[model samples]
Target: MDYNLMREFADSWGLVAMALFFVGAIAFALRPGSRKMADEAAQIPLEDGRS
Candidate 1:
């Protein structure tokens, strides 16, 4: 419950955790064969009830 301890964690581990998440997200988005899935998702709203 100490403020200093929490701040130190946020300044260190929290920063590194967020950076890794950012890198993973960027890599996933840029990977091969993603465009096809993205295009399908984009058309979801326009599709009829028939599957």
Candidate 2:
């Protein structure tokens, strides 16, 4: 494949693919029952040796 063809495909479809992935990631993060897990992760640094 030539550079022009590859560049064009990346310029168009690559942008679309990246945008869709971004939206899907945002949706996953905002879904129900995720807040508790996020909060627990946030406290890891402050927690002691206790597991």
Best by TM-score: 2
lDDT of 1 by residue, 1-51 (tens): 799999999999999999999999999988999999999999999999795
Q: Per-candidate TM vs. native?
A: 0.87, 0.88
Best candidate (score: lDDT): 2
Hey, what RMSD does candidate 2 come out at?
1.4
Q: Supply candidate 2's per-residue lDDT for 1.
A: 100
Worst 10 residues of 1 by lDDT: 42-51
lDDT of 2 by residue, 1-51 (tens): 999999999999999999999999999999999999999999988889875
